[model samples]
Target: MKQAKRKKLKKTHAPTLWIGLFMMGLLVVLAVLAPVICPYDPLEQNLAEFLKAPGAKHLFGTDQLGRDLFTRTLYAARTDLWIMVMAEIAPFIIGISLGMAAGYFGGAIDWLVGMASDTFIAFPFYLLVIVIAFASGAGSHGIFITYLLVGWLIYCKVARGQSAALKNSEWIAAAKILGYSNIRILFCELLPNIIPQAIVLLMTDMVGLLVIIVTLGYLGIGISPPTPDWGTMISEGQTFMTSAWWLSVLPGMFVVYTGVALSFIGDGLADRFR
Candidate 1:
């Protein structure tokens, strides 16, 4: 019975890592090729064509602004991808570095770093980003910074815990015995080992992050108009849901599909690693 349960659990988690990698790859391709593939300018609007439903010309239909939903979504991919990459890297770099430092030395710095990390972790992660978003005047750049502040703690916590575990390991002791520099051990040895774990965690959280960013846009608290964010698209479509379901539905589908793909890839990678 226990074996069967474990097998079921493995099957469930398999797709997460795989889907995550696929999503990441898709986002990269979109970022790079969206310009050529999407014929219409994402920001360009046509008043005459406004409120058009999904059709042959405009597959995803026109928005309230008569913008090509397909084109806008493709371009919007750029923004979403940028946010994800920036948000993840910013935290990954800072948090991992600080965490390594804190765990390796094990002194006053460790306590201070640990306490600060814990304090941030105590709060709801999304809430912190939202507050920072609003306070910083609420735009892409602002939101990006807010994301970094809110997200770094996770990486830091993980890296710190991982580093602590290796502090007394035989390999680490050998490195120390050989008088390896702190930089060599931290980057060449410690950081490299911990990164796979970080990547897996990042994959797991990417979808949730997408949802939060979308919600912020939907609520008018995220990327401003003219940007055509997915959340904002849904928000704009809400009033006309009965008449223009396509406006919201298409973008929402993109969000869900992309989320699913990334989640699957992430799960697969995690399973393989495990």
Candidate 2:
């Protein structure tokens, strides 16, 4: 019975995992190779070709500024994905470490961590992000600062729960009895166990983060001009939605595609880890 159950689980998750990996990997490769393969400079403009529809010359058509939409889209992928990964690094590390410490030490440490996370959770997530971003000023700096302030809360919560549960386990008590230092037990024992769940959360969290970035760009507080962000592109194209719908639609589609890919990854990982 157990063997059959294990096999069923494997069959269900394995395909989803592989499909997501393939889709995401293809996008990454294309973005990385954008400079080499792109026919035109993403930022270059030609008044003559402005608003030209998709054709042999311009595969995805030209925007209002006469820049190649295809090129800009690729470049946008590069910018957004890079920012997404970089923005998460600090929060991931700090959140996991703090969560582990709080759970392992308990008492004062746990209380403080709980208070901080709860405080952040009290407000609407996007509201906090927008306010912070507006105050911090535009571009990547604002985005990073906004994330740093709030992004760690989810990770901290997840890690804290896992650590707390594990702390009372027999193995944890055995480690204590065996003279393992608190630091060593927290990092060496607890971290390895908790990291898998955190990674699963990371996949889904990235999708949300990407959406936030696009929203910021749409609102004129992200990436800035000439940077080829999807949100900014959508905002710019909205004026011509009737005449040249591709401008807004194409970028929006890519955002959905990327989000779907990440969602698959998160779901698959969750199933696998379970």
Candidate 3:
């Protein structure tokens, strides 16, 4: 039966997931080593080499300012990875805690959390992110603030449902009878059960965050000048797209690559649970 199950999983799961995991791992390593391995300062400019096409000295070519696109692209990965981590962490913690509490307790707490989550959800998702970014002022700080303010709803909703379902389980009753503190029961028992599903959701949400981050950058409401952001790069590259397709295409590809990798990981996790 064990061998059969393994075979079943292998047959059912797409190869894209493994490929995505591999790509994601590679990107992480690249992001980590970017500063050390990058060929040039992403911000350094040489008008002499401006708009040069891919060659031995410069791989992804040069942007309008003659900054090496290769270097900028590598560094952009680091910026994006940092943003993704910072933006996701707060939401994960706060959302899970509120969700667990609301689900387990299910009274005023539930009503309050439900209302807040509903309010956030009612707004068009990307529009809310854009509004928050513009209102808070554009940059990493603004994006982080926006994500913390609203990103929790997705995780909270998922965790709430899971917690509600599990709250009355036999083991929960046993834990209560044994005098487990509410805090201990919620954190130790309920949290552990909800995490697997939450993780899948987290991976998917990261992709959305990446898109929002890029979109903000593209719209000039995100990472500021001299910072190598994929969206910013794409925005800057658009004017020269006819003459230098690589300018926009290469950085945009990085966004696509990361998104695809994350999507595969999320899909893989969902499939595993199924």
Best by TM-score: 2
How does candidate 2 score on lDDT? 0.92
Q: Which of the two, 1 or 2, has more TM-score?
A: 2
| lDDT (tens digit, per residue) of candidate 1 on 189-224 | 899888888887887677777887798888788888
Tens digit per residue, CA lDDT, model 3, 1-274: 9999989877778675687789899999998898888869988989999899999899888989899998999899999889997889999999999999999999999999999998878888778777877887878988998888888988899989999999999999999999999999999999888998999899999999999889999999999878889999999999998999999999999999999999998888777766
Q: Which ten residues in a row have the lowest lDDT in candidate 3?
A: 11-20
Candidate 1 global lDDT: 0.81
Off by over 4 Å in 3: 1-6, 11-17
Candidate 2 on 1-274: residue-level lDDT in tens?
9999989979978988888999999999999999998989988989999899999999999999899999999999999999999999999999999899888889999999999998878989888888888888878988898899889998999898889889999999999999999989998999999999999999999999999999999999888899899999999999999999999999999999999999888888888888
Instruction: Specify the highest-lDDT model's number.
Output: 2
Rank all candidate structures by their lDDT, best first, as comma-separated numbers: 2, 3, 1
lDDT of 3: 0.90
The per-model lDDT (C-alpha) reads: 0.81, 0.92, 0.90
